[model samples]
Target chain A: MKIDKSLLTGSTTMLILKLLEQSDMYGYQMIEELEKRSQNVFTLKAGTLYPILHTLEQEGRIESYTKEIPSKRPRKYYMITKNGRKLLDEKKAEWQFYATAVNQVLGGEGYVGV
Target chain B: MSECNLLVKEFLNITCEEIKAKRVHKQIVNELSDHIEEQTQYYIKQGFDELTATKKALEQMGNPTIVGKELNKAHQPKTEWSIIVLTFTLVIIGGFIQYFVSRANSYNSHAFFRFLIYAPIGLIAFFCAYFFDYTIIKIYSKLLYSALFISTIIGFVFINRINGTYLYVYYSAILFIPIFAGIVYSLREKGYFGIILCGILYGGVAILCLFSVRTIAFLLLSISCLAILTFAINKGYFKCNKRIGLSIIYTPIFLILILSVYYILSAGHRRERFATMFNPENDPMGAGYLSLLIRELVGNSQPFGLSQLKGSLANMKAELILPAYNTDFILTFVFARFGYIFGVIIIALFIVFLARIFTSVLKQKNKFGVLISFSACLAITIQFALYTLSNLGIIATFSVTLPFISYGGLGFITNMLLIGIVLSVYRNSNIIMESL
Candidate 1:
């Protein structure tokens, strides 16, 4: 099933937090990682990804700094805070609960049981 | 390759049209451009030609406007409405404090009405400052500072003079020393020249104050501005060493020492206030009289006692215990009439107001905005602290207003104007902070 834009909107920060909860990453990295890991199911525009990252940075759930590497210009990297970890854990449970409920509703109970 | 660069520029430029604070939008532009270039390079490594790689990169990033709008949502200049609301609320409270005190003394109620009349004017000043693009101040900060400084001198030299020597003006006028300092520093950039220029503007004003409006309150204010300049320089205002900045930053401190020494040796009304401050009881029937009155009223009032307001009111009306009950000593008026509970509330509000200005300064990426907002905050903080100290008999009663709450046209109006500047800075604080 195709995911709704509204659903994507709601989960954008949670997904970013979840990604950052594992490793520090830059904007393009996060975009590529999310798309790759989600089996090409997620394809967020840079425009969509960055504002969420910036907002999360301001919310103190994530913070950013630039690091220099050999043979490249410095790039901005983001890391999740403890608060972001807490939020990610909560979002994980919420998604689990939500998906299970949807499965139950869409499963055998919805057709003629009522 | 050059054509490819143009495409990236066009893309990034379109991304920042909605964002104000050019520097902030520039950072976003450059940052996003970095990502685009990286992606284009990735495409090139995948066997695409340069032109195709660039085209593909642009296509993948999506429309610049949509991305720009999304980014703009986070970077929009924010106004501190909580501070604005708190300021208006306190101004109303001040009006009530004045109204009730007037009524308490003479059984007349128009002072509050007068304040009500004044409220709209103050609110207009506040909003005008809030909405006025603060960046415009940079273009004419020199002219603005000179005008304020020259006008002060002209006001002192030609407009008002007591006994052709002792300097005095409306209490509100004195508050401008610190504000003018803010304006002075707002025009500064990162260098020794800016520091020297600040010293000139501040020193000229300080000297002008010395020969004319010789108020100790302003001396403290000038010193506070120096402290603000020091802070601005430390926080990337100048390229000077942070430790060395402290030593060189004594421009105001040095001015204060010279002026104090001059004031002491010159022998006039200035000497008496210092002597009186350190020892309030030295001359109970003379210079220390008002300070002593504030002390007894505040020191003796019941904490959280409503009845005490009436008692102070009756005492004020029945006997000439404290004069200027409506103006310089308005804090005492509120404390005496409304008791300590209301008094603490007023102090808390002032602290909150200054905090609002301070927080706004911290968020600013524009150096001018940060310095300007910071100086305004420091000046007002000093005024509020000194007023409270004087009211509690902890410091010399310099007769400064309690900012928006004080009963006077110029001080009240000027206070509103500074708040407007703070609001304007807050409104335009989204300067791209790549370095800061």
Candidate 2:
């Protein structure tokens, strides 16, 4: 199966942004949520996921806070920034357009040459 | 719930402080434990026994260190400003000790003159290093290489017009120019192979231009370059066989060049100095005088030494010794005057001085910082060691000057430039910290 290395990161970022849009979560919860939401179709490796969180934090697209949970360790929880919400909306629109264009071709219809 | 969880939690707590990020540790522990628990629960739900499920979950967790390290890499905090300030303070203190205290007792007009001439050169080298962006230096490696080549050639051609010995005049810049350029280019280029090539080329030319006047200085310079080359190779910046082959090729070529130059510049007294070094009795009053005096001072100071400036050996009543007491063999002079206690103190100070520089180098996180700082430290430390060893008769007298303490323009300026390079590394480390 061919994989676009470039798309992997952007998709992971969008997935993270979308997930955090629901509620703030730590790294493990984020990974679990992504897996559960996608029915294991997207297994976000810890290595790939943390850098995206850090990059988002650095970009001010997300903000993180730490809270101690009883019977478990303290976790750094990431929440989407206003800027992050804005970016997520724009990315959703762009991805919708891209998915439709690709699906049109994959759906067995010949390209209406433009 | 799993064996791996217990082991990983223990390991993570123990190593977390070393990870450089407080936030990362919390994130990693939480994430890893949750994942392990989830895996164990998943396996148990699939009808495995509890222990068996835990074993499977633990196995599927992969290496905790690999996972922990990836997390650490992603969120490692920029080095704190306190660390940078502490490093800079230590380096400046080291430089001050080397300059002032190390050479205090040996004050003289010649020493002052040497300082005056070389200090400006050192300051220029320092500023050049201080203000120049290391990235720009690396990006224009070829340009720096060409500049070094052209300058060396220009100095060589103009050697005859200079006041000093032809060789000394021609190659004085060899000490700092190539080293500075090498470091800058290496840092910018992401490897020191280019710097090593430039060093070898410059060193090869120095050997070609060698004469009796600066043979020892040239040898010391070449050895310093080789030390840096060795360090670069050890750090994996250059491939092993390539570096080894280059050294092997350079050595024989250097020897041949030196032999030819020696033949051209060989004067009666210069040849006699070489002969007398082997057997000082051959011309005790002539070329052998300095070596004999050095041996006598060091020998007399054994177990413990005579009082400072009090050794009759250094006084040399009616004996032919070098006219100046401290120019070349200041170590011996210091030992004779201050006794073995002072000698040990001086050696200890030099070791401490080198140790501090090395500490700063090791603390640096970036590759360029490590290489440049380490190279400069190695150069100074080896020179100091060789000078001390030769003075104590542990090696042949190579006419090497004690760094910073020695009274020579070239030696002094080169020493300052080295100090400057180290400081530049510290400064850049601060900038990196601030950026983070």
Candidate 3:
């Protein structure tokens, strides 16, 4: 099922931080990985991803570095900072709590019977 | 292949055109073009032709204008308004102080008019530095350093001295501090060799200071240069082991410190100055005279009102009036005339000015900006501290100007220019990329 575009907006930062938390990534790698991991439900545009990445970088949540890859152009990679990891944890808890609350409000398993 | 390259270049140009920060356009374009090329490779692997795949990648990256606009928003050139505002406030305060101090001493009245002229000239110099592209320093680091070094040596020998001090000569040499920062930036990739090169350059300044007998300028320049070098080393800009880098930088300074201490102890006049530094009563009418006078003046000063000392600075024969009241001892004059609170207000303003400069310095991402701004901050702050400490009799009295507040001269203009460079670094903080 296609996720609503608006539904993904607020979580994009959390997702990007979460992705960087696992390993440092360049822009294109992060986008492709996000799409594959989300089963193609979260195909982020390069336009959208870079702006968010740059903003996180400015906030010191993430930092960018240029790494030379063998036989290829130097790539600018973004790594999650300590602040970014702490923020990701907080975001994860908030997401869990939010999802649980929304499920409960919609009656969840109780609504399954209904 | 060529067709595909043209297509990618056009997309990059359109996208870069949208971003207003022209400095970061290359970096952002490099990054975006990499993304497009990667996407095109992926599509080609999935069976699309090079041109077709390039078109597909560009389409998926979304609209060029929107991407550029967003990138532009993220990379706008930053201006530090707080610094600009504080500098103006300090300059005006300095103007008022100079006016009043001149009014009190007719012999020094020309200083007020000079202040009128130098203050605007200094402000023009400040803005000129603020608007200048500091990258020019990076590009011309060695050339600037060599030219300034040679000229300073020439100035030392040829320039006429006023009252036994090389006023403009040493003042011009102070410009070496920031230019050395550029030199350090240019030498970053050379590892330990870079540190040694920097040490050699700094040794030149130290030797110049020693030969010219400008102890205070030497002390100020050395400490400021050491701070800049240490900061760069600690930031790992030199790409060498931090411990070794620090040791390489400090060993010479440590040796110099010991040697200078030994030299001061051995030199008859310097030994007398040193001994009197601790107990001014020993030489009440000679080397210790100024220290004792400062103590007497400050000791009797009231917090809210001027001191009761009655002597005309214009006459130069009074027991109470300090020498160079308009230049080096302006703070003491302010305390004597305007009260301690007013003096504290000036010091507090400097503290804020320094604090603001440092805060801006910390926000810099570009290493070149960091070096230039940090060195400027240290240079200015050191002069301000040394002058204030000297006025309060905590340190030996020397010929150091109180940055903006001192009667306007070459030192004041240099300080203004340094502040301008710092502001320029802050102004380009966001737009410039960190060097790899």
How do the predictions measure up, each by TM-score?
Answer: 0.75, 0.50, 0.93
Model 2 segments more than 4 A misplaced = A1-114, B1-137, B140-142, B145-149, B152-164, B167-200, B207-213, B233-275, B302-322, B363-365, B396-399, B408-410, B426-436
Which CAPRI quality tier does the interface of model 2 achieve? incorrect
Find the candidate with the highest TM-score and give its number: 3
lDDT of each residue in B312-365, candidate 3, tens digit only: 433232224688887888787777766788888989988998999999988887
Candidates 1 onward: DockQ, in order = 0.41, 0.09, 0.67
Candidate order by TM-score, decreasing, is 3, 1, 2
> How big is the RMSD of model 3?
2.8
Instruction: List per-prediction Cα lDDT, in the order shown.
Output: 0.71, 0.60, 0.84
TM-score of 2: 0.50
Residue B299's lDDT within candidate 2 is 66
**Model 2 agreement with the true structure over B82-118: per-residue lDDT tens digits:** 4334434433433443344235434342445445566
| Candidate 2 global CA lDDT score | 0.60
Ranking of predictions according to lDDT: 3, 1, 2
lDDT per residue (tens digit) for residues B128-241 in model 1: 877776655656667766676667666655674665544444332344544554554554455676676766666665666667555654565566666777676667556667
TM-score of chain B as predicted in candidate 1: 0.80
Q: What is the TM-score of chain A in candidate 2?
A: 0.85
Candidate 1 residue-wise lDDT at B193: 65
